[model samples]
Target: MKHKRSLLALPYVGWMALFVVAPIVMVVVYAFTTAGFEPTASNFTGMGTYVSIFARSFQLALIATVICLLIGYPISYVMAKEGPGFQRVATVLIMLPMWVNFLLRTYSWMAILENNGLLNQLFDAIGLFDLINGLFGTDLTYFRMIRTQGAVVLGMVYNYLPFMILPIYSVILKLDRSLLEAAQDLGANSAYVFRRVIFPLSLPGVLSGVTMVFVPSVSTFAISRLLGGGTHMMLGDLIEQQFLGGAYNPHLGSAIALVMMLIVIVCMWVMNRFGQGEEQAVVL
Candidate 1:
């Protein structure tokens, strides 16, 4: 049985070695080497020029993650407390957009946010812009919703919100009801029970949702490109430029990618430690 199990693992092991390990090894090698394949640290040292880009990426990602949490947690909690029929419908509605292609979804948002797009058209039809202009004594044609940092954040929130929701919903749904009842029996009110019992227990889910939302939001290129209109270039776009764009520096791109991965790892480690502390406190 042991030998059979070892054989069963061979395919997965090979797959990881080929896909995951190999790519990571290549990235590490490229990150630490020059274009001439000579070992060098300047690839990382030369990233000072892009400090603003890094800051913007993390800032936008954090904002999007916070927004997702604020919106998703309440929805998840409600779904968890609701009936099976409600949960089913809500789950489908949440997941329905995911069935479409990611690019297509983003493109749809681009259309909606453009100067003369559907949203602006609707605003114009309803005289919203006229009202604003009339009140402010200014001439206004259309709102510049697209090609801004706000647009980029909005895209990140829309694309990744479901990731935040599903993990929290699953975790909240699986929470032990007896514990909630015990809290209530101990004279805890709804708010007190949630703060003391529910929220503490949901830390794992919150952390997971945060990770899921933050990682992609920080690394996103297309959304920033399309929605931000080249004004808000993120880390992903910077990396892409090094490897594939006019810059053509794979070594630098790899260095940026490696640093980003390390930063994300450190952030997650810190969050996990915080979550563990919360869980321990709850246990006590």
Candidate 2:
């Protein structure tokens, strides 16, 4: 019976081989081969130009990840402590933005943040910009809010925030209230209880949320492209331009893809280490 049940997984294994394994093999081959199918190091030899792009990408993603954590953790905590009706309404509201297509959401931001768009118009109507300009005695009318690095980071946080919230919320909801009560009975204050009890148990969820938000934030091209106005180039943009842009260099594109994969793998390893620490804390 065990042997028969094991055989049931053969189709899934075969699917992975065909879809996952084969594509990775092709990418590896392309990364190392020239257009004529000959081995060449030219693809990697040209990585000097991409160093700044990689650094900028990492910086932007890190900013977005940290912002998500700071914003999401508190919201998740509140949601977890709420009644069923409140949680239901809050969950729907939190996830409502995701019902729209991601590209559409991004485009909507473009409209909101554009120089002549709703935000600037609202500022003009409210006389806030005029007040600032008058106070400073400058002729400034509209600040350049869109097409900047900050805009890109804002887009990332907005889009990926729910990924952070959901995991932490799930973990917080499962927390043993009895432990919290016990700590309080022992004269522990709210801050002390959170510091000693609640936070340690929530590490797993924090790690999971970091993984979910960071991985996608690091590789995202669309947000950077649309929000940064193509001035900010990340690893994803480099890979995209290599393959689909004017260059048409599959070898270089594959190399960039491999590098992105390695970065994500490193992030996962770091998250795993944190998870192990969480387990140790639980044991203690």
Candidate 3:
């Protein structure tokens, strides 16, 4: 039986070795080597020039993650507390945008947020711009909503908000009802019960949602490119430029990727630890 089980696992092991392990190994090798295949650390050393890009990526990602949490948590909690029919309809609505292609969804946002796009056209039709100009005594045509950092963050939020919602919803929906009843029996009010019992138990889901949202937001290129119009270049775009753009430097790209991976790993570790601590405190 043991030998048979080992044989059964061979294909899975081989798959990981070929796909996951091999790519990671290649990235590590390229990250530590020069274009000539000679070992060198210059690639990492040169990263000083892109500090602002890294900062902006993390900042925008953090903002988007926070927005998703603020918006998703309440919705998730409500869904968890609602009837089956309501939950079903809410779930479908939340997931409807995801059924469309990601690029198409982003393109739709472009049409909505562009200077002379649908939003501005609506504003013009409604005399909103005219009202603002009249009050301010200034001539105004359209608001510059696209091609800014705010637009990039908005794209990230729209694209990744569902990721934050589903995890938290699943977790909240699965909470033990007996515990909530016990808290109530102990004279805990709704707000107290949530803060003391519900929120603590939901830490794992929150952490998962944060990880899901933050990772992609931090590494996104297309959203920043299309929405930000190359003005707010992120780490993902910077890495792409090194390998595929005019820069043509795979070594530097690999180094940046490796550093980003390490940073994400550390962040996840910290979040997990914090979640565990919160859970432990709740249990006590």
Candidate 4:
């Protein structure tokens, strides 16, 4: 009775069961099936599809995840250091964009990154635009960062920043300040205190942030679509393409999706390990 009660404890678990787990099972079954409703393969013919995913889509996701983590860490730290009032204000400011539609925000980025955009106007005002025009001559648009890897990264950071910041900030806010004080009183310098005390204390936040940003950013398709000129297809975009009939190979697509999921799960495990490692470093 106790075990049964524990199993059914989560109401939201039903949603997870229906949506997340069910879809995953569907993909798994579909991955080994060929088109035209054939029952030839049985979860064993997706090796080629899985291989392509590793070679292309996985690389794209890894780059995007790295970009998010690199840019989000410092911003999260600053927000965490602020007082409660300020933290709330910053949170509101940071989260304000999330209240708006994601597609709208992506469109906004396109507006600024397109040719004859606001950024080019600012650059021209500063004479840098003309300087680039003189330097590159026929490649002003490319120089200005439109439809490139940089643009894709920019879009990812914009959408996922709040995800990274919120988790890290929550952990940092609850961190004990006494540890830093103790380190300082023991004649440790500022750098030492930060390296030995503050950073270790904030590891939980850091790990949470890394996991939060890394997983979704890796699998995200929209940023690459709008900013990457369709050439920088991430795993999300590839999976999405299959579902939306662009690829027309849903079987192959499911294999790609499952492989991407495995990568994310491994990353999540690694992130949790880092958090535990950080905890071990703390004196208490």
Candidate 5:
């Protein structure tokens, strides 16, 4: 039985080590090495790349994460506590947008945010046109949504909301009914119970959701390119630039990839440590 079990596990272990561990280890090492695969002890280059990614890449991600949290929390809470039928409907509604091409969804924001776009038309109709137009009128501007930070957040939220919802819903679904009942019986109101009990127990799901949204939002290129336009750029776009743009530098791209991994790791650690609630981490 033991031998057979080991045999069964062999392929799984091998594949993980090969694809997951190997690639990460290689990237981490290469991020520290000199370019052109000619291994060197040039730690200076790696540190410099790391510093650059920290300052720029993380700033965009921070903005996107804040946007998702401000928007997703109430929505997730509603779905999690609502009737089953309503939850199902909300699940579909939230996921439906994700079914479309990510690039298309991002580009669609352009039409909404562009100069002379739907937003401007609506603003003009509502008598706020002069205020908006006077603020920073420019024929070539794309500020309503496109070529702006808001557009990028919109795209990231649209694409990654499911990530936030699914995990949170999973945990909230399995929340201990008795504890909530006990809290209510013990003279606790809804808000107090939630603030003290329910939200506390749901830390794991919150962590997972935050991680899912923040990690991808930080690295996504399509949203930035399509919505934020050429003016606003994320690390993923920077990585693409290193390889595909005029400044084709694979080594730099790889270095950026390594930095991304580290950022994700650090974020996960922070969530696990500081962001977690006092109560035990709940599971779905």
Candidate 6:
């Protein structure tokens, strides 16, 4: 039976090696070697010049992740409490935008936020721009919303918010009703019940959502490109320039990729440690 089980897993193991392990190995090899196939530390040494890019990416991703958490946690809580039909509809609504292509969704934001786009036109039609100028005694015609860091963060939040919601919702739905009831029976109020019971048990899901949202937000290039209009460069943009853009330095791109992979691993470890600590506290 053990041999049969191992046989059954061979296909999955082979798939991982071919599609996942092999690619990672190739990237590591490229990261450490030069175009002449000689090992060198220059690729990583070059990263020192682009420290600001990594900082900006992490900052924007952090902001977006926080925004998603603030907006999504309440939505997830409400969804968890709703009837099955309502929950289904709410979930579908949350995920509806994901059906469209990611690039298309980002492009749509560009159309909305550009200087001469629908947003400005609507502001003009409603005299909002004039009102703002009148109130402030300035001659501002538009807000210059696109091609900026804020726009990139907005795109990141819009795209990744659903990821934050879904995991928390799943965890909330599986919460032990008896535990909540026991808290209530012990004279715990609504706020107290949630603070003591509900929130504690949902740490795993919160961590999961944070990982899902932060990882993608930190690594995204398309949203930053379309919404930021190449004005701001994130880590993804830097990596892309090295590999696909005029720079055409695959070794440097791989080095950046490896660095990011390490950062992500460290983040996961920290979150795991934090969650375990919280779990122990809750148990006590």
TM-score of 2: 0.95
lDDT of 1 at 5: 100
TM-score of every prediction relative to native? 0.97, 0.95, 0.97, 0.83, 0.85, 0.98
Residue pairs with clashing backbones, model 3: none
Global CA lDDT computed for model 2: 0.90
Every candidate's lDDT: 0.95, 0.90, 0.94, 0.75, 0.76, 0.93
What C-alpha lDDT, on a 0 to 100 scale, does residue 214 get in candidate 2? 89
TM-score of 4: 0.83
Point out where model 6 deviates above 4 Å: 282-284
- Backbone atom clashes (below 3 Å) for every candidate: 0, 0, 0, 0, 1, 0
Per-residue lDDT of model 3, residues 1-284, tens digit only: 99999999999999999999999999999999999999999999989999999899989999999999999999899999999999999999999999999999999999999899999999999999899999999899999999999999999999999999999999999999999999999999999999998998888889999999999999999999999999999999999999899999999999999999998899889888888887887768
Per-residue C-alpha lDDT of model 2 across residues 160-225, encoded as one tens digit per residue: 999999999999999999999999999999999888888888878888898888888988999999
- Model 4 backbone overlap count: 0
List the candidate 3 regions with Cα displacement exceeding 4 Å.
Answer: 281-284
RMSD of 2: 1.8
The window of 10 residues in a row where model 6 has the poorest summed lDDT is: 275-284
Off by over 4 Å in 5: 41-53, 125-127, 130-143, 280-284
Q: What is the lDDT of residue 233 in candidate 5?
A: 68
Q: Which of the predicted structures, 1 or 5, would earn the higher TM-score when compared with the native?
A: 1
Show the lowest summed lDDT stretch of 10 residues, model 2.
274-283
Q: Is candidate 1 or candidate 4 better by TM-score?
A: 1
- Could you give the candidate ranking by lDDT, starting with the highest? 1, 3, 6, 2, 5, 4
Per-residue lDDT, model 1, residue 77, is 95
- Ranked by lDDT, the better of candidates 2 and 6 is 6
* Candidate 6 C-alpha lDDT tens digits along 1-284: 99999999999999999999999999999999999979999999878888998999999999999999999999999999999999999999999999998888988899999999999999999999889888989998888999999999999999999999999999999999999999999999999999989998988889999999999999999988889888899989989998889999999999999999999899889989989898878767
